[model samples]
Target: MRRTTTGPRDLPPLGVQQAFRLPETADVVLPEGLRVVCLRSPSAPMIELVLRIPFLCATENDGATAEVLATTLLRGALGRGEEDVDTELARAGCSLGAVRRSDRIEISGSGPSAALETLVGVLADVLTGASHAGTEVDRARRRLAERLPLLRARPSTLAAEALRVHCRGDSPALRLIPAEAAVASVTADGVRALHRAAVVPAGAQLVLVGDLDPERTVALLAARLREWRSRRPVGTVVPRAPEHWQRPVRLVDRPGSVQSLIRLVSPAPARTDPRFAALSLANVVFGGSFSSRLLSNVRERGGYAYWAGSRFDDILEAMVIAVNADTATDTTVSAVAEIRAELRSMATKPVTDDELRVAGNYLLGASALAMSSQVGLATAVSTTIGFGLPPQWLESFSDEVRSVTGRQVRELAEEMFASATFTGVVLGDARLLAGPLGEHLDMVLA
Candidate 1:
């Protein structure tokens, strides 16, 4: 056992501090075809690795499969059970995570730089040399399956699920709910096959950020992960244009519910689009933050909802505006109508100079505050790599927000609000004091 003086782990003294921004990532094409994009953050006393791969949920079926894959990741890896792995992480003073979203599969972790070797070794073991016999999978399947009954007991969860089923149509995101069933369907063969197909070499980016020497860190990683191989090609068939893009405005009928939870989603610029900056600024002014238009109208003046704001999903694939509050169900009609009106107003009227200034300031200031911490800085760097952005992209964020004029915001609003361009999703008891909503917006009863 080692005793430390002051540091959290009481590890040996560190050597150096190095600042970095998207340094030329060393492309170590492994013999097994895995791509290693390594960025050494030598300044901090921690090393973080993001084994993010391009796992696309192209179709609903594919998405469902991914859902199963994400949860079961911690269930067992490297012949270890979830309990063993989770406990190991705790003892290491490290955290490991898995996120399977509509767009991609993100697996990331961080730990004291003193344990950089242990961190990378375990990570590579889980990602590449993983297999837990069959006991872990069988145990996880039963545990996850037992939780399905709980969703029915919660009104909010039920209504949200209903809306997703309606709006997503046959998308995998909707199908992958109640994670237990998804786990049960995943056999060891199915799991391994998915890993081979989805989590291969070209899909992997072993992002290393920490206080270790750049050369040494890469050297250590190369030594451990040298034999790890990628089993499949880089990409998958991309999901087609969403069939439910103009899904009927669904009022998920949650009986006896007091407040309405409204969520509207529509297509936004893709991550690869050049207009991302402009759209990002537009989103800020329109509904990106707490002091956004939707908030001003719904909470400030109309006194309808307490929490109302919208944001562009950082992925840039879609823009979703979520608003929730505990008001009478009877007020739902007026509330929904008011939100729609606010959208039109944002599109038509020029944002005030004060509005532009405040929003831009918040955007810029928030960006700076976010990047101030070690974890935040690591996250920013990981985001840059995961979402495909340039090294100097963060520097450009404030400038873009400041340059966004009232004119630009108005233009974006009108462009975004065009008919059928957006779909509305409401989680409430729809049968409460309803007017003719289907005449304008597509309506569905969830």
Candidate 2:
């Protein structure tokens, strides 16, 4: 049998035909001050719920306490056993979990649209009536303790933590990983106290997305969550991470390691800043995507690392631009040099029209894809809400990305990627990296 090869197939035109639009959104503020941002997606059969509680810990110990509380929030609630809670959620075609961040405690859940009420009721029960059983707390503490060593062993993790500590200084956000001693010391009573103090209606934002009427859904949630109230006024704001101008390069020694993890941290504009769109486009061209300069230079062209990328994190008033790469220990210096060169180029040179167009389309495409599902819609809505953006902000994103000119990108790049902007860390075998890295950086051994 002979197979005949045809001529190359024509590819379809890239980019959306029209501007993407967000689902209809409704905002409601309950009497208890729990704000609800609802997105009605009739096409989806599932409901997605994202509840964000402003959860800044007062002390480093409180960080571990809050994490344990979040992990065990749904272990048992309203006199029900852990198994019973799981059974109820399974019956409703729902699953729920909570994560504790430096700035917020996010409780995320999803289920069939018809069982939205059941999910909300379960969440409310967990919020208001969590048992915080001694055994459960001990188990969670042990689990967290057991995970610490594994996390510490990863070079990438070490580099990221160091970068956070360097950029955030003494801010509570610097406590990304709880201390094992602190986790061990967290008692059930402590967890309960932290939960009661931090998880309050006034400090919470509930974002729901699904096939339901926004007003009716908000009313239902209001009634369901009414039982979970707080007496104390809620204003637990995380302090802004202090700015660091010193460009110190710290080396976290991992004995006999074959690869090095490089992480760079710099200040960035917040999401609400008018230059955010331009900066975002600049990042995309720099390293935000697979077709970015960092990947091309460090991985594809230079073969200095297996992967490379950069990300911008917008945490309320705080913002950070982080670049990450992993490379062979022998090529660590080369990879770092390439990364530094790329950062300098971003500041000194204007991006081409093609770069701007590709970045704009990529951003718009990503935004459209993010809003295509119930969960994604909920996440997007919650993120924008966290950024203090209005519901209509989503509708304007495509236009904003499209309107970003190359000049704007260049200006933002110059502002964001100046020589003094970056402070970084490299984690690897110091014996292999220290001499070479010290030649190019002000090295500090950790």
Candidate 3:
């Protein structure tokens, strides 16, 4: 039978809830100070591994060097050429790659269960004997130097960078993008030095989930990482969020542009907070999802924008809620007003029971889907531990979401969004925006 529904609230109930549980896991610390978390999920004969190396540095200027280092880390290591490394991984039925994040360098890999030992050996080799050869470093530098300028010119990138600079001073730990000049100046030797200093296992974590024995996996890691030693832990520094911006909203001029980018951000509670789930639900009701009030108001109904939504982002020691929209240049002012109005509505008006139920179910379903695969399970475990949460935190998080009441969502929303907490940048034509946006928001020309 074809079912008709007016809204998420009208959808059928999710039937009896099954208790969420995680597989048995073994957590161990190697003598070399490396933390390994292993889980035995025999659903498939494959294993996924994630290694997080804290890559904090003293100054934002080091970001360029860090990028180059990550690019060349696995290019050629331990006297093995790039092709040789590829052939070995292929023979082991393994695939490996890396990405440089603001605070860490994450190396992820997966392979058949039988190849766990071989995969670990390749990871160890990359960690200790990465060549950072001049050719590779130079090639990476040129690529970054060419790409960064284009990235900087992007409207979305401009808004994000502006938000970071406004909320948190430009520090190495919070800076998201490196300057083009910095990328151009990175050298082979510099990349190598940064690698030696920041890629140690002392303060790193490794997560493995698949068809593997926890004890044996731990033993393998201990044996393989025996030589991966360091005297000092990876340096970490948490940047503080400023209480206020010089202006509540900063406007950047993109002359003759046909569209405008609006980004709003505010501090959010840590994941460990008891009320975090309520706030998370409130975010969904307001703007985090397609059916969210912010999107329904601006894009679906008002036709002020084509893209509009909100999300939560995690930083080193904190979290933030951000709302973003890309709208026609002429609708920029109306879009901002609608966004602020939705925020006000979310705070002042108590969310309906239907709205609360819909958001809660979405959160629960997303959590379930996230843990349904080896890669997903591994990522979930990695993220949980990375946030300083217990390995079983996922088991209880669903309950937290289910228990949140509409009243609590309203109160939390009022506390979080019913103020001038948001500070952001709007990229549009100043000639068309200055007069109207100035009256609607406390905006300054940038």
Clashes of each: 7, 0, 0
lDDT by residue (tens digit), candidate 2, 183-277: 88999998887777778888589998889888888888888888888767334435566655565778888899999998877888777778888
With candidate 1 superimposed using the best TM-score fit, by how many Å does residue 53's alpha carbon deviate from the native?
A: 2.9
Best candidate per lDDT, number? 3
Q: Could you estimate the TM-score for every candidate? A: 0.79, 0.93, 0.93
* lDDT to native, each model: 0.62, 0.83, 0.85
**Model 3 error, position 252 (Å):** 2.2
- For residue 115, give model 2's deviation from the true position in Å: 1.0
Tens-digit per-residue lDDT, 363-406, candidate 1: 66777667665566667766765666654576565556556667
- State which candidate, 2 or 3, has the greater lDDT: 3
Can you tell me which runs of candidate 2 are displaced by over 4 Å? 1-7, 15-17, 233-240, 314-317
True-structure Cα RMSD, model 1: 8.7
lDDT of 2 at 183: 82
